[model samples]
Target: MPYADVNGMSLYFEEHGTSEDTVPPLVLLHGGFGAGEMFQPLLAAGLGEGRRVITVDLQAHGRTPDVVGRPMSMEAMADDVAGLVKELGLPAVDVLGYSLGAGTAARLAVQHPDLVHRVVLVSMPARREGWFPGVRAQMDAMHEGAADALKQSPMYELYERLAPRPEDWPVLVEKVASMNRRDYDWTEELSGVTAPVLLVFADADGISPAHMVEFYGLLGGGHKDPGWDGADRPASRLAVIPGATHYDLMFSPLLVPVVRSFL
Candidate 1:
């Protein structure tokens, strides 16, 4: 278990493939209430030779130690990521973050644009006014002794398909419990990202069922500046996996080709 002392916490991470394989390392960030290991399916899908993969467990989750003073703000998470990359001597890397991780990745690309070459944001929430109230309420409910809600959640159904059994339930429960409530903002951070972006989501994903329209609309609205100079904004790609939800699309056979084409 490799660990990096970063941002007042011991961050856990694993490196796969080799830096020699790709020019820029691929940094993988998992979903909310998920550890970096969520990318395992993608890794097994065979992303190709010479593509190094670095998966990180955010602080206080998985094998990482929680930072004592800092709440798990996405900004802090981004800083942790930046520190890890610098500590490991990585020059620049491509970033792939899913769900909550996607939000953090967006912040990173905006705040530390020079450190990222390309970015893939999967199953992210649409940045619309008042869009997060319901979701936040649900998460808050779960945190405030409504743990039973987890059993009825759409995400739980997806998790069941991935890891079924009473024994595995604790892993999922701990993940939800460990999530920091304050780190769920994407409104002000989305516009600052400058990396070539790929947005991937499923049509029926509970968190992002209408994500394609909203996400692509944001990209094309011209209201958002990609933080690039005139005429050189990194291109964006939007892909909606048909007939799949969030959990299903992760291991769905369709995702591989799209990922390979972009990354």
Candidate 2:
């Protein structure tokens, strides 16, 4: 077990694929209400082969403890992750984040570009507006009162099994709920990102395809055609995995190969 004191809380992280691997480390960030374990399937699929893979448990999620008065916010989580990279003494690392983690990953690439070499954002959009109306409604329903009901969900089960204090489940719920209630839009900032990015989404995702295309446009994509020599292509990519949905894309077998190639 390894822990790092960062940003007023103790953060937990796991390593795979060896420290000696020549490739830059890949930081795997899990979705909201989940832990690093969600990426087990991807890691098993050899995405980490011959590279260092680091999976972090964000604040109040997984093995990381939620401190009193310390609520979970995208900004805080991004800072904590950057602090972890600094603590590890890595000049820069590749980042792959799913859902909530994707938000943090994108923020790092935008606000802390020096710490990120390349980034993969899975099932996430640059703004809350990108999500379908119903999806935003569901997020609004996530209050502390919903914690007990969510216990029937595997997300809760995993938290119970891995949280430093299982009683904090409700706390985590409220914090995330609060964070979600606040509107966010990173679209304006993304164009300034220095690192290359990969935007991956499920074909049947919460984010409409049109919005995703707009997101790509913000990344300087799709405005022009890529010439035969690949000279006009954007530094970023947009990949929508076929026959997948947001609920299951995290474990989609097709996910590993695409991400591995991008990294």
- RMSD to truth, every model: 5.7, 1.1
lDDT of 1: 0.70
Instruction: Give one digit per residue, the lDDT tens place, for model 2 in 1-263.
Output: 99998887899999887756456899999988999888888888898888888999999999999978976788889999999999999999999999899999998887799999999999998899999999999888778999899899999999999998999889999999988877998888988897889999999999999999999898888998799999988889999999999999987888999998887
lDDT of 1 by residue, 87-206 (tens): 899889898888768777887887888899998888776452223456656555555344356668754554455332433444445545545343444544565565778888887765
Alpha carbon lDDT of residue 155, candidate 2?
90
Candidate 1 is scored at a TM of 0.76
Q: Each prediction's TM-score against the native? A: 0.76, 0.97
Q: What value does the lDDT take at residue 211 in candidate 2? A: 90
Count of clashing residue pairs in every prediction: 1, 0
